[model samples]
Target: MEIRLAGIKEFSVADGPGIRTVIFTQGCKNRCKGCHNISTWDLNGGYIQEINSLISYIDSICPNKKVTISGGEPLIQYNELKYLLKVLYKKNIIYAYIQATI
Candidate 1:
């Protein structure tokens, strides 16, 4: 499977506890006012990335750290997110996700 993402933050302390690799998935329906990542709201925006390659990249660069899947809206790509979560689970990597609610 493939994932569309606005970008990836290799290291972030504000996203969650400890340093984390933040996967900023593309697309969102919320369209919250003053949203900082408004550009990520387009479903067809951002570049496509292979899921396996993403996992490998994270494994190599973000080992022993939490992986935070933020967005645009991570849940918008739930299937791919689930797969990514499963892979992370097998690797014993901790993860968290954030979403906007209204």
Candidate 2:
């Protein structure tokens, strides 16, 4: 599946429990007050990426670390994200986190 993304941080310490690779997906329904990623709220604002390429990139950069899926509300693209999570699960990657509002 293809995933729309705002950006990807190869390394992050604040996203989750440990050092993690943060995947910032594009598109969010919420426009909460004090939102920091306002630019990512548009559904068509970010580049599309293939799920495999994303996983491969993560593997190449840093594997076995936590992977945080943030937004633009990561759940906005639920199907794609679900598939991505499934693949990650099948690969024995257990440390995945999703940051979403509601």
Candidate 3:
């Protein structure tokens, strides 16, 4: 599955406990006034990444670091996100957190 990604930010402190890889997904309808990621609001914007590639990138970065998923809204890609979470859950190498705007 191809997912719309705003960007990948590595080694963030405020996102979660310890160093984390943050996946900022694209497409958010919420349009909150105080949204930090206002640039990712457009669903048409951002790179389209395949599920496998995303997994590989996350795996490669799983060097004792957690994986935090944030975005315009990850639940917009619910099915794909679910799959990715499942895989991450199985690895047990990276902790995962999904920050929902809702």
Predicted candidate 2 versus true structure: per-residue lDDT over 1-102, tens digit per residue: 899999999779888887789999999889999999999999999999999988878777766556888999888888999999988788766778998888
Cα lDDT tens digits, model 1, 1-102, are 999999999878888888889989999899888899999999999999999999889988895558888888888888999899998889877755565453
Q: Please, what are the lDDT tens digits per residue for candidate 3 over residues 75-95?
A: 999998988888777877466
Compare the candidates by lDDT and give the number of the best one: 2
Q: Listing every candidate in turn, what is its Cα RMSD in Å to the true structure after a full C-alpha superposition?
A: 1.4, 1.0, 1.1
lDDT values, one for every candidate: 0.86, 0.88, 0.87
Model 2 stretches astray by more than 4 angstroms = none
TM-score of each: 0.92, 0.94, 0.93
- State the local distance difference test value for candidate 2: 0.88
Supply candidate 2's per-residue lDDT for 88: 78
Candidate with more favorable, higher lDDT: 2 or 3: 2
lDDT of 2 at 54: 88
Ranking by TM-score: 2, 3, 1
Model 3 misplaced stretches (Cα beyond 4 Å): none
lDDT of candidate model 3 versus the reference: 0.87
